[model samples]
Target chain A: MARSRNHEQWTSPPPFTQEEYVDSRIYSDQDIFEEELEKIFKKSWIPVCHESELPEPYDFRTTTIAKEPIILTRAKDGKVRAFLNVCPHRGNMLERAPSGSFLDGSPSGNPRHITCMFHAWQFDMKGRCVYISRQEEGYQDRLKKSQMGLRELKCEVYFGGFVWVTLNDQIDMTVEEWSAGSLEVLKPSLDEEPLEVFHYHKAIIPCNYKLWHDTNCEFYHDYLHYHNRITGFNDAYFARKNTGFDNGHINVGSFEVQYDNYEGSHSREEISFPHLPPNHWYMIDMFPGVNFNLRGSSLRCDIMTPLGPNEVMIEFRGLGLKNDDAVTRRSRIDHHNSIWGPFGRNLHEDLLAVTGQGSAMNPRAENRQILHGRHENETIHDENGMRHFYEEWGRWMDRMPSNPDKPFVERTTATSATG
Target chain B: MSNADAVRDSIYRSCMYKDDMKWQEWLDLCDEDFQYSITAYSPEIRNDMIYLSGDREEMRGMMKMLPKHNTDHSPLKRHCSVYAVDLEDDGSMATAVSSVVVYQTQLDGINSHVDAGESKVFLVGRYFDKFRISDGVAKFVEREVKLDTRKLDKGSHYPI
Candidate 1:
């Protein structure tokens, strides 16, 4: 094979048509990234944190959605609620720490209230504004404490106690309806017992958030993981189907992993999750990018906070049964760390690949065609998961994936030059 | 040499061998029952996490398979400061505490022209180590790396 010259490279058409390829601009364009924050991220129900993270009545955790700071707090009545972290007085951020309990009093504020350190304003756990600095002295009649409540977002704890929050109050669907049954595959295992997070880490990678989600959506890149290749390349693995659901979610069917095939690794059957078959693995890739993966002994979840067109912050959590004994918890942690930990065998490899993609596809770099063209009856190696995700993305953005400058046109069939 | 001197020498050698990618030399300094682990505390979940851990035999097997994996081949240089070394009354064991900062020079096969030659601090952590000493020779029995830096960018295939 010979390399193409500049003119030939520019003029040659790919072996696949619009449905099978997407313009790289969607991953690197600044304006398109801003539009995605408005149309896709803010409007969708996102799993921000697990309910176990805020176990106590006054426990709170802070996070961001589409760059807007959000705080989740458990009220005195045993309910978890979400609100904009910004304060109503002077728009100061209410909470700065990642997580803590509001039961303790601060130097300038009372106990059991979310306090704004800026001007000594405070709100109750239920987002009711309870105090303002010198309330009766400063515009007493004009600004009543009752009307100064925090801007509360729609929050629901569901699907195995994950705290789901949506910025759009007009959103038509609940978290269950939005999932479209994509989470049903792991429901038996996850919902059977209360899970507690045992490991947590975050990586601010230089890549579009979707690229990380794409890695979770398909398994063709398993060759990059020598451990996975050795332990999971059997016929049963190849036959696992990639099933796409409505609203762009996809589920990869379960298959037993042969852990004994890899040297120094043993079967995790003895510590398998509740109701899940021994050594089996299941994955649920939620649309616009959150991944829930259960591999027999432990469950791992990846949540993305998109920073820009070329950067994303990914938070990874590993969880196990809340009532595990010391020995069982140790084994569960070992199993979880061996594969998905920050210094694990597989997580770094995926980060390396996506960062490489980010470097090549930086903003203002040349636009190129990225192929999602492989056709394998929607099996493990097929590209159907990404295809389905992009379809939903295009619908929300109202722009074609193949050419962002053009309007989106729905396609009913796969029409590739080679197929 | 004194027991503290021997333990310090062994700790320095471990850093040098790992930075140079001399896996065999590093393993040779480890005792037969050596255990290694990397740990960090996450404020997001208010929990301590064990990121990686293994025994001597497991480390040997993982080192043997490193060549076949897709890794960030950037070279790491560990800067270590041995703060203290305390020897047991019987002189059969020693414990050392050190602070370490690892710097990674970006040299990947996919030289993207943007980050190819830049060097950056990759990790900031403290090493809490235990050693077994016999005949003035110290060997690592346990090394627990507690990292203060949680955002490990692209992370390393090998231990810090």
Candidate 2:
């Protein structure tokens, strides 16, 4: 095997390395971010919209896939589907609201097709354009409804009733395969009943997506949490096992923290709920931007988008078992917010740490990030998870990971450009 | 004091003492049947969503259990200044509107504040609230703190 090298340099460091990285690379490096938008985000099956958000026919919620706008809606048959949120005519955004049922200004609760506010161009739940304003007079029969449906995205629903969509039709991996390790952490909650997101919070962290992901992927930074002393985050038993699979996807970090591991990544900590393990924290970095975390009884799903190299927008969704009593659900929400909410103790500290890093690293290109973990352990685990990401990144960007130190490679074709 | 003044003073003192972290003094000002809450307008439904609402016992349990959990942000400082008061004829009840600015100070010394709201009051400024108060001068009969700022600056584990 090639001798593993630390990519840190004083004069000019590679944008990212297994070691510390410079701050400006995160904020200013458009080339690196575009590669991520393609290799990881566009190809990966991302949880675009939730099934619960669209309970009735024609009910819809518009969301983003990287920079591409998409909408999720329920068909007349009650099947959930995903479509590009842009209208077929005039390129106007079909729905302007951040989240709601429909955009036609019609009374809510009544079942009706989605009608674009611009020209009353209506679409069925399947995204087929059903009605167009003054159809027979101006345009004649040239505009076929068959060719004018809202562009559909590759979509699927998980066993837990969560909805996910992918831009690439060629990628063939089940949600189970993509989220293997995370599913273990999620099993306890999933085993009970289908989970629904009751509470949602978002923060646009001014840092790189990887910086925030590293904050969750590693367990060595408890000293930063001032409250961790009381919460038992200081224990040395908070060990982590980093594992990565083929295709540079499905990277998992499992910790043998101060909690009881019921079986897999699941833990029972007494800090929040007595049933929740105090010592366990498991996170799965799903290829590009999405990171799913199971911190005991509560579930936190984070989507980090590269607003730019330096700025990352992190949206958090909190999930709980569907049949929870009002009190139990509220308690879980309290516990989740206490630790990881935008105002929570743990996440706030982590955000500060990464934001501080962003400020310093972006301007100085010589810094590198250190990820030297257990390489010789019995299994193929190490900072290999991080390495796999860069390797895949290198593969897609036409750069060399073995020599990621080389000058940046610029791509002529926009990664978003269609084949 | 007139009944209107009594309810007005009661709401003022309760908010004042609560801001000072004087949980006991805040509880003492409330009536046995008092009701209190903190709510927000959800633009999704164009309706109000209550973030916190409870009686004295619920308040006590919340205050008791809050410090035990972990949190994401920093300390919050609330300033509630009453601007107008509407009194009932018998002085047994009253309605009060106030403006409030809640400042949340982060560890890095960053502070963000929510600066607007209106409060509805009853039993104009009294020692015991018109509603039933519970626990050791440690709770309220009823309370409601509504927020005009829909998107919170940074959330806190405790009520506003």
RMSD of each: 2.1, 8.5
DockQ for every prediction shown: 0.71, 0.15
Q: Would you list the clashing residue pairs of candidate 1?
A: none
Worst ten in a row by lDDT for model 2 chain A: A259-268
lDDT of 2 by residue, A216-334 (tens): 64445656654444344332333345565544444343443432211111233533322344545566666566677766567778767667677777767667676778777766666
Candidate 1 Cα misplacement greater than 4 A, ranges: A1-5, A8-13, A412-419, B109-112
Question: Per-residue lDDT tens digits of candidate 1, residues A240-286?
Answer: 98888889899999899999998889999999888899999999999
Q: What is the interface RMSD of candidate 1, in Å?
A: 1.5
Candidate 2 chain B minimal-lDDT segment of 10 residues: B120-129
Task: Name the regions of candidate 2 deviating beyond 4 angstroms.
Answer: A1-27, A102-111, A180-192, A227-229, A233-236, A247-281, A362-388, A400-419, B1-99, B103-159
Model 2 error, position A47 (Å):
1.0
TM-score of chain A of 1: 0.97
